[model samples]
Target: MDDTAIDYAAVFQALPGMVALLTPGLVFADANTEFLKAARRTRDQVVGRYLFDVFPDNPNDPGASGMRNLAASLTRVAATGERDAMALQRYDVENPDRPGEWEERYWSPVNAPVFGPEGKVRLLVHRVEEVTELIRARGGPTGGRTRVLEAELYTRARELQELNERLRRAHAREREVALALQEAMLPACRQVGHHRVAVRYRPAVGALNVCGDWYDLVDLVGGNRIGVSVGDVVGHGLAAAGVMGQLRSALSAASRVAMGPGEALNILGRYASVVDGAESATAVTTFIDFDDHTISYSSAGHPPPVLVHPDGRTEFLDQATDPPLDACPDPIPRPQAMTDFAEGATLVLYTDGLVERRGEDIDAGLARLADSLARHREEDPESLADAVLLELLPPGGATDDTALVIVRL
Candidate 1:
């Protein structure tokens, strides 16, 4: 069967057992048919409502522990990102037919965590099997047969708990591998010439901890010059990361011996034409020559680097720009530009993630970056990097990977 064509909503409603979806805040998101039937609730009645609000503790049962026990179990799942298989509990539900009356019920419930990309509990899968009939047949809740059923249910719950633990471990391992791959591909920050360099990389908040965005710094042959570049591949995760590694390495190697940033990018563009998944990738490279007091730069459809003077003036280096990698029908020389910078001026190189936001023009994002850089012009490279990220990214973090490099010249 074509999975994409399958009707997931239909499948969910048709599932054999009672199942419900809850947000981390314990608000009902959805409920399957069996769940609605078991609770005598309509979809409209439960969805978007808080669990406790819909099924408050039985008012007549002065010692009702149902809500307390179930709340504790759900809280555990949310806090720990683990499953909590609750023992059979006596939770009474209001009789829909008789408004003020309550119907005694026993339920075997299990709450499991559903993790988002950041490995946080995004939702809870609440599954339950009502055993009111079984308990009643076994001579009420305190009967010997009821105790035996509880024991059997507990054993099954333990098995389910073990399975959940294994799934969690596997998820953790995948995250570790993604992080290790990212660390391995990206280099450590270091000082180049008299300037302090700071680098930052944040993967998108998702199951994968890596993306196509990358940054590099190469201390050129002469101690007075250093080459720094930032590039973004077209995708995320391992496939994009693999392409990023290849493109970054090519640029680094070319920058070492190429005559200028434009020449290095031309070489990289040619290489990109042959590398799979490199099409439409964008990059910007800058060579800071301390001795000459000049900054030479080039862009392959990437955003211009920002230059912040000591006196709080900001300039965007957009003079030299070109289409993204392999956008040209044939190999051609890329454009380069040179500008002078005074001592203590700071240069910022970053991927689009630092400025791009949903539903906003890129110019707005660039303006925000320029304003932030001007405000923090005097800060050191590390402080400026931190400030830029704090000001530009959303409160929850960016939706895409961001690779940033800051150099104080």
Candidate 2:
């Protein structure tokens, strides 16, 4: 048989594992049926697209290393003309039927460089074997292994278990550090002027819950005016916390020189647009005037502030609000809503995490908050804040960070 007569394309297509040929520039040259099945993509969808553009990292999870590791491996293979095998990686794939939805997948990959007749790297061969099910099974026990392979399987399982344990410990340590950093950045709840203030911050239950929920109280230049704010940034981890700190500091500074709540929020919205890595944030800022016995507040896509009257009647100050900071290209004027606060009345400000749940409607959460506030209307500000958190969040923990602020006249 002539070697030139062999159908290389047929042989490549018959391979069981996922395989793709990439050009020197990393464009998809050819992909086998297995590769198409694993990627959930057609030849037309991926053939001409850049590798990263076709399969980018998960936007919501900044810690995902699949794209980074794959890129590095390809670059190394191109430079050294050698095969590179990578460890297991969590590479999420987008659902073809549902836009913006991702499905979790784990893969072990190997990259080998294909050389041209000129002795230069021309094409790259990439192969992947999915092991997501095997990994999930290894966490528990498995049955029906032959005695000959039992020892080998047991050793491999033990190694995987140890790796998972180490990852868990590392995540725990990271959570601890992030919590401490968030705590150090947040402002302490204390009295401002004659108004009594109390604040509560509860981070989410798991290791990944450390986020950018923040509340702050700022004393304006005038003794009779105080500024209060609560905000939730878009993502989690140190990046979100850092953006929260920057926005908090900017809001505080703006409160000192700016006229009122609307002006402060306008400044914050403008600043958020220029800041790097800031996608968007929701915030509510209020200007409390003791001399006037009134509260003026503005919201940037945040939940409405709740007010409890001296008679225990509760009202949500829902008003026409602008979009969240950094959410849009053009800036819109933030409108301030004014309402009178009677003596002994209380006001509550909180992030969406205080009210939002996985399957529950947000309106229901807000209604529950109002009910909780009305029930604890007679308590002091400190006690009222504590009661609300205890009632809503309970003991175990919430799925997202919760920040609450209560002010009593």
Best model per lDDT:
1
Candidate lDDT scores, in order, read 0.89, 0.83
Error of 2 at 196 (Å): 2.2
Judge candidate 1 against the unseen true structure and give its global Cα lDDT, from 0 to 1: 0.89
Q: What is the C-alpha lDDT profile of model 1 across 307-329, one tens digit per residue?
A: 99889889999999999988986
Every candidate's CA RMSD: 17.0, 17.6
Assess the local accuracy of residue 210 in candidate 1 as a C-alpha lDDT between 0 and 100: 83
Clashing pairs in 1: 117-206, 117-207
Model 2 lDDT per residue over 269-388, tens place: 999998876676888898888888888899998999998999989978876477888876777777888989898889899998889988889999998999999999999988998889
| Prediction 1 TM-score vs. true | 0.62
User: Which residue window of length 10 is worst by lDDT in model 1?
Assistant: 186-195
Pairs that collide in candidate 2 are: none
